[model samples]
Target: MFHIETEIRLVGPSMKTIKVSSRIECAMICSNDNCCSSSYDTILEHCSFFRDCCPSKEFSKESQTLTKISGFNPPPKDCSELPAESCSGVYVIQPENRPSMTVFCEMSIDNGGWTVRNDYLHFILRQRSYQVRFDLEDFTGNTSYAVYSTMYVGDESDNYKLKLTGYNETAGNGMSNFGGSSLSGMMFSTRNRDNDIDERSCAISRKGAWWYQSCAAANINGVYSQKYSNSAVYWRSWREKNGQKKTMMMTKPKP
Candidate 1:
């Protein structure tokens, strides 16, 4: 599958250029090559292949950028479909009936196959059972993490409800404070899309989007700051005053 971006063209050294009868033919040629990006000139029926290219702001009525989706043939539903030996990097994936998208996979953590995506958490979590890991760093430079053996979220129709269990105490129960609270059933909330139970938009007040119940007991997506603040990244059960200096979330198919 190819993602076609209209009015934009891939800007880079062209490896080859040929006259094609249609955009489909151009995409087919690109698919066979090692190239991931290509450009098609609608008016002239010219197709240009590129080794490395991205959609540039140079808009043209006759140009369209085509990015070839790379991964397993059917496109892995998630990173777990990739070989265990696959290295950490960005790869393409397409969920059933969903659009193709690139995701960064962390292949060195806990035997690899961890998919990382903060924006589309529910979209991926809803597909299957996963083990969630949270890596956090406090302002004082102390680092800690927490892992949940079972985690998943509901669909948008369900307000992206969150569900988590199987906390690994050995890894530090950073979520102990609220992981089992109303947060488990709380719906995801954002600045513009308020599904949280709080009267105010927790996403707006906290400066980030998350599953909030009357705000939050822990918010890793919160604002990055050096001092304590309600909007700063924090895990109440871990460290509160000084919001975390760094935070990361990753998930993989549960073993």
Candidate 2:
């Protein structure tokens, strides 16, 4: 039997941690199936997940930081000994009102069709978009790797370039608790037009924090290592292009 636990946390604009009562609720599933797939709904009230899910709130003039949740577990006391990656960066925003992020990669022919799975983590704030690039030398037979990527802009505006910043990679040994396989980034953010140039705005320069987990990577770890975060993951063994492989994050299919 497989059990999946979920947790959500919300931080105040002032960086204050807010506690909220929340639990995972099952919307639909199939049980005792007789072959035909049927629809059903169930509520799991005993879900012991407790955290601050900073529910949707109006943007206030007060400048504050969002709590960056790095992983399913809490961070270690001493980060100096861990091999962490920069989890945030200033990305060129493809202004839109959808996905808010995307992943990019090149097609591969060495392996069969491959699949890429991603998770949107809200460590600091939900990322406005997720754009990952993969090498497609094998699939496209190109002399160089081309970027196949997607873009999920937020609802803020159809014309605004977002600047993503903070980035933290987990420890290499697989003991990253407040860590998982998820990458994090900034959500939809724009200029505070209400404020004057002399006023303090964009108070926090740090990128919205969070993490990303590849569904493909987590599946491979089962056979290789014991420690979770540091162990080998699905990214190492994705098929070249026989199945569910992502070429890029474009508005439509590539030419």
Candidate 3:
């Protein structure tokens, strides 16, 4: 059976569009074809079919509606496998051996196809090779970023060991401090999970989860604070103070 949603529209490019008499007809056509998802415009009596295994959804103020037919193929592993016209938004993905999840894609950045990191970071990284990008913004409104050619994180059973290399110096290697002995090869540490070599839990001491050695030389997941401190978002190689206003870790399949 297929599920239908009213006043909800699929937000990506449609592979085909045709005039239909009703929503049922639209769904029937999509069900017969290999398309996994489709949408229908009630007022215009139009039907649109998408090739995306799982497309992004958005509430529509118009008469448009979307549908998801069951028994179709599984969703893509990452945003890079999506169509070139896919927009920046939340889409469903299923990494190898992992449950389906909704993740935001940064489509506006460098021709799009970037998957924002979430709790499934390890699962996504372990599924395949991906190039990682770090975006940082300071309280002064200045922004800087660093891109690595390769990044891999082991599964939980392996302590989520981090591996990074191939720094692109053109973007200013602010992550150099993190790619050193301080973080590379280190297991991830969190507030409740202690995996660092430090005598104490770095996550509890620093107020964030990260791959830490004795503590951290650079931590992008630190707490957001107005003042500089060991618990605030910071990249020591770029600035001594934790005056960061924003930070983002994004990944995409390496070209």
Candidate 4:
């Protein structure tokens, strides 16, 4: 799925580099990009992306300025060319408990309470989160998307974000292959790993209440759950509980 290589440059067919928040974010950008094969960067966030080549540790690097780079295998350009499929899956909506549901990758959303316009999808979670299983190629070729709209950032410190990824394994990078599939970031999985819904999937959290907690004790105070690194999937979609809302964006790449 992904390989974390350090202090090396991947020289090959190149694409233009743009400013990103962190090295992990940069790596993820490359991972989602079918045209990008590897990523290289330093603490300054000066990153380079390659298309035709994979990660390599054999490169000239000044001994003192040692830095690590993360790489992932991006899909082919034609991956998303497929049309949308029908939204076929078991959807359970209960007003009593947290409002949750499951969706599949090949399923269409026209009548599944999901709205699509232009290139973005929109939906609402009155009191909780949801498990969205759509191929990454369809949404936006990347794991992260711009916040088109949000209900409220109740707690300033809380993170209001969404994740397009696979199962949560407490290991390197906090992600692993789900259902024996190598597709890591775009699978639609649920908070309840043991649920009847698919476990090999991705998730979106507009505002969450620390649902899938790795912590032993409940966090009474609305605080961001335990996290490892900026790029760690465990903390990627973590959200505050007070004021929860659901709204996401998907940007279509230029032809």
Candidate 5:
């Protein structure tokens, strides 16, 4: 239903995978009409490409590492009170394969004309990680990628306080001060900078996971977490060369 957590695994410059950990069917109601808010007893498994988060970025057999996948620049939920200063503004991605979610349609200058390259993207916030993916694509020239963004949630490994202060959400580069707690840490982001769009409106969200503590307890809120799964791979793509349908990437976008 929703993604509680998403772990990104970049196997190659053009190939990466996303392993999501979330719940499945939502529990329904009782005789009283008010359904029990308890979570589903079982979890689900899903595997997809992080690049699949965007469609326009994928290339056909003629694929090349025009741009590499960033290690993953997690982002803080825009609504979160975390200030820009206190966030990990500078994404410290592996230089070779830095995360490049924000990409412009670089139509071949000589053969460039009427190319609307877009990677309709989305984010999944979980207790530990924020996963991203693209769902649309149509391109003429080759595509380029950019590190769209990264955000943070919480990690108890350091301290009970949810104050890591800026950019500490980017994993490995996350937090050193707080070592080894078990707080739910998540960073969600997207390539779509246009927040005006309906889809971009949900840069951060939940699945079906609940708080380990009580809703009234510290770091414990009675809100529904996102339910993630292996089937999270919902994407589409098409490519045109010389004004003819050259190829159709029948797969998800690769990071």
Candidate 6:
């Protein structure tokens, strides 16, 4: 979730640090600091803090390092704060083989789009993981995959705080090559396929998997989505199906 990296450190900006006995202890220090987003641990029993919670920099494996999110322990019900009917954002589920291509239409909120696809895009927030039964389909409602895969969530953003951020499939069909590549072991990302910027949206593929083409994308409230996967993924996906398609969610015009 919190982009944990070993043998690396945040180079540009920093927040604070605490001396801890182990790498996990370093995470504990970050967990207590609200301002801290990303954390790094040195072999010298010191933990480094970063103001930029989401470290965009590359991790250097040469250094002794271990990093993870500081605070993410929330009850399943905590996600209840999100709207039950629709999501505040949209997300795309990409496959491993295509890399840059989205396997399913984007999920968003619109004129009751979520209601129509409830049967296929079922989301349930569990005690430890947010689960989604993702049934792939095209804008015309044509089935891309007859059956849905039960996917566990992961790879969350720093603006949001929900554990198990990586949108991964822990069960069901393990992985499939139907659309392009196997779904198993894929990681989540929110970076726009076009701009390569995180629209604060959710994405699920495998870690380190690269996309060749930037076909389409979406935007999402990291915090709200974590608290409300049903509304976020369902409605966003629906909007995409309805032809509100784009490489990314269009930036709302300023009033």
- How close is every model to the real structure, measured as TM-score? 0.66, 0.17, 0.67, 0.26, 0.16, 0.24
Candidate 1 lDDT at 206 equals 85
Worst-scoring 10-residue span by lDDT in model 2:
23-32
Residue-by-residue lDDT tens digits, candidate 3, 196-244: 8878888998888888888876677888875788888887767665658
lDDT tens per residue, model 4, 17-45: 66664443454455556543434343344
The top-ranked prediction according to TM-score is 3
Across 113-170, the per-residue lDDT of candidate 1 in tens digits comes to 7777655667777677788988777656587778888887888798788888877743
Clashes of 4: 12
lDDT of each: 0.70, 0.22, 0.70, 0.28, 0.21, 0.30
Better of 1 and 4 by TM-score: 1
- Error of model 3, residue 209, in angstroms: 0.9
- Rate residue 80 of model 6 by lDDT: 27
Minimal lDDT window, size 10, model 6? 245-254
lDDT of 2 by residue, 1-255 (tens): 011111222122221212221110110111111111111111222211112323233432221111112232223211111123311111112212333232211112222111122222221113223332233212222322223233332333422222322222321211111234222222332233321111322211211111112211212212232222322221332332122211221122212
- Write the candidate numbers in order of decreasing TM-score: 3, 1, 4, 6, 2, 5
Whose TM-score is higher: candidate 4's or candidate 6's?
Answer: 4
TM-score of 2: 0.17
lDDT of candidate 5 over 1-255, digit per residue (tens): 122122222232213222333211111111112221111111233322222222233222221111111133353222121222221111111112233332222112212211121221121122222222111211233432111123233333322222222222211221111233322332322223212112422222211122221110111111222222211211111111112111111111112
* TM-score, candidate number 5: 0.16
Number of the candidate with higher lDDT, 1 or 4:
1
